[model samples]
Target: MSSLKSICIIDDDKIYTYGVSKIIKNYLPGNDVMSFENGKKALSAIKEMEQNNDELPDLILLDIDMPEMNGWDFLNEFQSIRDKVNKEIQIFVISSRIDQKNQEIYRVEWDQKVDDFIQKPVQVEALKDLLA
Candidate 1:
């Protein structure tokens, strides 16, 4: 697969963010990787980009649990404004909340916005495939 230009990582773990960013940078040189401590900040940046007519991230690595705004709420908010954006953004849920897979909420909100789900301590091989 071809490489993506911009990738966003939304998670609270600084170590996880740094490690993942390193892997992505090494694996896909020249790719733009940005990180947000929480979904609220990520969403705000994305919305601002929209208003400024700037290019949004091509892919987003999302976490289910976060402060200020959880991944679910972020997804909802993003989906609400999707129509206003012209680009296709692929969102992959990368969270440690494996139990969420069995919840009814996944079946509902995930049907449209989320492209796929990945467990935390994100597997390099799987991530490589996504980044590929």
Candidate 2:
């Protein structure tokens, strides 16, 4: 695939963020990769960028479970901001907690907004495919 302007990852796990960011940089070095510890921090940064009229990331990798604002909350709040941004941002929900209960919740609550669902411990080939 052609290079994206930027990609954002919102997750509480520092190790996962670092590793995934590294992989993206290695494979798509031209793109900017950003990470946030949780949804709240990510939303703050996103709002700041929006206020500044800055270019937002083309893609967002979101984690389902986190402290200080989880993925579901982020998605709900993001919808309003998204309309004002005038940019098409693809949101991919990446989580390790896709049990039956959560799957039903996601299907019922957010099936339309999310571009895709990626399970945690994402495989290298799958990541490549995503980038491609």
Candidate 3:
């Protein structure tokens, strides 16, 4: 697989972040990976990168729930700057929530904004799928 120029992981769980980062590193060595504990920080970082005319990440793994700003909030902010960044950038929802209703909402309402929905405790095969 071709190496991604960059990727972002937005989640409140440190363990999840570490695990995903490790998997990404193992599969796509040398690719830059930026992570944020919440959506607010991630949004701020993206804005800064935009201001500097830096290329946005090729993909984004976002969590649905968070303390400061959730994934939904980030999507709102992301829409505001969508034109400033790469419109083709892929965003994958990674959440531990098992709420069927919320899943339906995400599938129906936010389908256009997100690429795929991945469960928590990401597996190596799933990571490989992402690479593929």
Candidate 4:
């Protein structure tokens, strides 16, 4: 598979971040993989990158529940700055909550904003497919 230029993992769970980054590095060596503990931090960093005319990540794995700013809030803020970023970013929500109601809400409300909703403890095959 062709390597991706960059990927961002926004989650407070350190173990999850480490595992996902490790998997990404194993599959797409040399590609940029960044980890942010929360949506606010990621947003600030991305905004800074935008100000400096730096390239943002093409893909983002976001967690719904986070301190400072949650995925829902981030999506709302991201929409405002989407055009400012040069990349056509794809955001996927990776959360532990995957009830039918939540999925339905995503389908009806967040369909345009998010690419996919993945369950927590992401599987290796699923991650590979996502990377592909």
In terms of lDDT, which candidate is stronger, 1 or 2?
Answer: 2
Mind giving the per-residue lDDT tens digits that candidate 2 earns over 26-90?
87677788899999999999999999988988999999899999998999999989988778898
Model 3 CA deviation exceeding 4 Å by range: 99-101
User: What tens-digit string does per-residue lDDT give for candidate 1 at 1-132?
Assistant: 666679999999999999999988877778899999999999999999888988899899998899999999999899866867778888988878755645446757577888887777887787788877
What TM-score quantifies how close candidate 1 is to the native fold?
0.90
Top-TM-score candidate index = 4
Model 1, position 89: C-alpha lDDT score: 88
Candidate 4, residue 131: lDDT: 76
Better of 2 and 4 by lDDT: 4
Which structure is stronger by TM-score: 1 or 2? 2
* Per-model TM-score versus the true fold: 0.90, 0.91, 0.91, 0.93
lDDT of every predicted structure (CA atoms): 0.85, 0.87, 0.85, 0.88
Runs of candidate 1 exceeding 4 Å displacement: 99-105
lDDT of 3 by residue, 96-121 (tens): 88367777877898887888888787
User: Best by lDDT, which number?
Assistant: 4
RMSD of each: 1.9, 1.6, 1.6, 1.3
| Candidate 2: clashing pairs of residues | none
Worst 10 contiguous positions by lDDT, candidate 4: 79-88
